[model samples]
Target: MNYITCSQGHKSTGGSNFCSTCGEPLQNSNHYLEPTLIGIQPGTRLRDRYIVREMLGQGGFGRTYIAEDTGRFNEKVAIKEFIPSVQGTGALNKAVELFQREAVTLYQLQHSQIPRFWEAFQENSRLFLVEDFIEGRTYESLLNERLRQGRCFSEPEITKLFQDLLPVLSYLHNQGVIHRDISPDNIILSGKTGLPILIDMGAVKQVTVNVATNLQTTSAPRGTSIGKVGYAPDEQIRLGIVAPNSDLYALAVTAIVLMTGKQPEQLLDQYTLTWKWDREINLSLLMTQVLNRMLAPRGDQRFQSADEILSFLGLRQTNPAYSTPNYSGNSTPIYQNPAYSTPNYSGNSAPIYQNPVYPTPNYSGNSAPSPVNNSGCGQIFDASIPVPQEIKGWNWGAFLFGAFWSVGNKVWIGLLCFIPYVGLIMAIILGIKGNEWAWKSRRWASIEAFKANQKTWAVVSLCLTGFVFVIVFLASLGGS
Candidate 1:
């Protein structure tokens, strides 16, 4: 039997005109006739390293090929070719430039849940990117299989799925790169690790660049938006403005699709431009609320970050000290630890640092710190709580202001404010040693100068607390 490869690189034994797997035309006669539209043929060697096996898929922008890396123990790799359907040499040059620039960023990305980028090169007038070949089916295939079984994903399964995948999105956002297209089709479930791997970074279309350039020259609209319809938000589809929250919106839509076993278009109300999910889906109230927050039509109303969603799910603790590292260009990649230690508050003791000057007064190294109430006022006048008396220890101002406090006082611990509960912990520490931290972190000309600043911060904190109480009381009275 003669074997033929489909456009999706699936091998079929029967000699049919159309591929049995992907339903793509298998005959060379039916392929695009343009000389420029040809894909690298199977068995063709490029750069004396990669041997092309078959065309995986093609879109308006590029073609993906399954290839074998001869230099790397015959490891299979996915090679993407930049072949935009544009006629002019100028258009082709612009596309190649964009591809090259984006390739540099892609190559630097190193994550377990993402395909590792190997190399990028130009050969035979075509730009190509090589990355690790993920041996798994896309989420799209999994959804279809589940639907065939007459079942949709359960709430717990969807929650677990998002928990596993949200970190990948968080990692990407930390690198300042947004996965503009985050549909089920772009996510592949790793057969080896059983993890969802993000693919198709190329879906971030160059429409923004093209439009900006065109406006500078002729004020003409140029290039089409690059994203899957229904998955992408109105901001991205209409204005081409994408942010980390935009990916969250897509993730929420993916979850809804998996839960309902319906296409995004099917679940969405065309007129209202909102999801029309049936109310009887037996989902937990917490999960439902999280999904609603994530799917809020306005970007601002949506959960601002993946960390916030994780916190809402009770999977992660608030870390006030964690700062996501920038990974753009030549910057070193910062690895973030998802797990965090909860604050220890069980006995009358203070936290001792490595520095002897910052040692707690009665900490025996065995006794645990006394538990303090979360109520703002309880933390202030609780005499049973051991407060650090060091003049220059932890700053309450830094805790309340968080990153701003760190910047103001030149204390690095302020970065932890980015973590949810870390700020509260820092604030508690500051309540004990705010004056000390403020004094040490600043360059005051005199002790009096430091004392005055601390006094001011104390007054400010008190005023803010009272103001909050007044607002709450007024709102309660209005409700009554």
Candidate 2:
């Protein structure tokens, strides 16, 4: 088989970087040759195994084909062809190196969310890499289809997409691999399950070397940006700095576009201001907040890692009900247990070395430990409620109210003992940490806090009852 000449009319002087006639870099022009079967062949095969069927797609650097491997019982595989320039002494060698690199990169990745690479070989002066054929539409197709149908996806649906890809992105980042190009076109949706499989690793960068990382972070060469312009993060475009968080930013944009059925460009133009869309989707506040954080204009403003976004969404955190309070936002829950206060560890007393001081403590003891005595002040709670880490970020105003109530209970403890039912009610109110104090264990704490006030409450109740009886008797005599 003869190597095809480029459009420059220069025949590929086998394995050269530039053409001998025009001095311009020459590529194999016969890349459009479809793969033929073993039984029906016009020419002898390169390895006598793969029979080219037809060209699937082509890019600036390579082309993909749907081919049948005769040696493997005629199984189908997608083959990528890399055309080496006919100029430099080792032009073909460099092209083969890149082909091998792509094969190796794909082989190392074994996640269910990524496509699998099969084999690589050089045929008829052209380098080709074979991979498993995914019979699915790209995410770009799905978005267009939804838009044509005048429909949009819900937040839950979008969350399922992110949840599947989050772990994959984390894996790539941990391995120091960055998919510099992350966009709808690069994402393939499984036609059978509607799940996504990330494809195209030619643009992936391995930043294991410090020199490569520094160079990429400083200046990105022209024509290197393969990601959709709107979906690509600014840092990735301006600087070749591709990080795990950058992929997350693109995913967030993808989610927004999928949920609203809007084009990425339109969304980017309107991103600076508030957006009102025609679609209706039931999205949780937590999901929306995480998405916005991921799509923040600056990379620093976005989540530091994929795990951070997952934590904010309450997905990666082990506790199903453990919710973090909003320190910088207004939607935080207001927990009020009037009978208890968070202990002041910042005071002159040496701080208690609780393992998870602000977070939920791991209780390994036989029983729940008693509250520490800070003279007379201590945190009180109902024995039943589980305390979480978010409680540490609670408002101190509630704690102040509990402190005053505790003092009042100590001074008037005896008053609560005299009035029978009234005295009992007062004691219970003072002892139990109710909604007013944000105490999780309000019942137990309330009983202990107001023990001294019970007697005072009882005497006051008895006096009020006697006075009411005397008044009633006098009124009856006057009427007679």
Candidate 3:
């Protein structure tokens, strides 16, 4: 029968041996199965070792399987089946190349976080790669579990998580390897190791030609633009350049999601309005500030290296405790509620006064004698009163009238300028200086004419509007 049911329990039928829909083997029976090896079947064992068990997951490019080794080996492995495209010859060839290249890249990797690659071979035109099977959950699963508990991850949990990932990225960057895809799902939590193991180096590329033997370097950078959309940085989404800082940007977004238990999309919208650290997070202020900077829209504004982030976290370098001075009347920390109050300058003592010295007056002259010490109810000149200065400019009444006059003149100038053809050019020139000449001069002249009447200000907005209309009219007529 040229038909088979996928591990997803979906039925597929076609001429090609691979499942027409999911690209799995079409042979569904046993005993008389098409091919066989060591109690297993053919079209199943790629390198005569890995035994294809069942499907774990599938994406647009490839399908992952939970397979086991049967050839003198008893270990579970993940077989990533890269099915050649039956549609286009060019695409089939390119997919095959990418599959082989990815295997080679994985083979060259030497990090504990990265899965170890065993072998790469073909089974009836279908490429399969065997890699270490990470047993546990993905970061996405962990996030969901945290959410289900009605609790969000704490800052320390997030910091420890990223701190562990930073070394992996730092190592890759030093080797000129850009992961190109750093999302929560790609990060697998290893139950045995109790740490995140970065998986699926299929999209990984060597921007530098260090270990890659058959590397293809183009004027274009040698990494995939295929990253988780929301977590992907703006540059990576818009332009396909994969720099080390790009990873930092994604990691920052991941950290935010982990801390807030919010999807990247929700956080991104809030971030567009204004990005700031979660007040609930208890990490160092500098570290939070650094994460905020990492998510900056402009890549140039972001930090250059993971080491910078590490240093800000007080891991790679020493960061001095910077205490800001208290600006509020309270001297307590700004983070505190109902900030502390400043101490009063005076204690409980009332202010004391000195005895006054009065000027003696000539009683014999027409001038009255200065009052004697008035302790006994004699009339007293108000000692606490302040004397007003004499107005040097025009009186307040005169100043007000002059302002009214100047405003009237401004209106007249506007009416005159609104005459039509000549008005446009005249308005253009005077519009440039309308406030500078007419309205401003009135205010200046008013201030000059009446210091006491300085409080009286001519509302120049009406004058300015009138002046603009006049100038426009003049320009229109002049053009005609």
lDDT of 3 by residue, 1-480 (tens): 433333333344534455566677654332222221112233365455566777788765457888878763768888776543232334334445555655554566677777888887654335577788899899888888989998876777777876777767766554435576787788888899887888865242221121132333232223234567777786666545555677888888887877777777665545234343343344444555567667766655566667767876766422122111123332211110000111122433211111112111111323332211111111113333211232222222222233343344342343434456755554454443333233222211122333322333333444555788999999999999
Weakest 10 consecutive residues of candidate 1 by summed lDDT: 334-343
- Per-residue lDDT, model 1, residue 275, is 63
lDDT of each: 0.62, 0.51, 0.52
lDDT of 3 at 423: 58
Winner on TM-score between 1 and 3 is 1
User: Over all chains combined, what TM-score does candidate 1 have?
Assistant: 0.58
Q: Of 2 and 3, which scores higher on lDDT?
A: 3
On lDDT, the leading prediction is 1
Best model per TM-score: 1
The better candidate by TM-score, 1 or 2, is 1
Expressed as tens digits, the lDDT of each residue in 21-107 for candidate 1 is 677765543221122456778877877778889999988767899999999989899998765454344554555555665666676
For 249-314, candidate 2 gives per-residue lDDT tens digits of 888877887887776666553533322222233355466446656766555556655656676676
Global Cα lDDT for candidate 2: 0.51
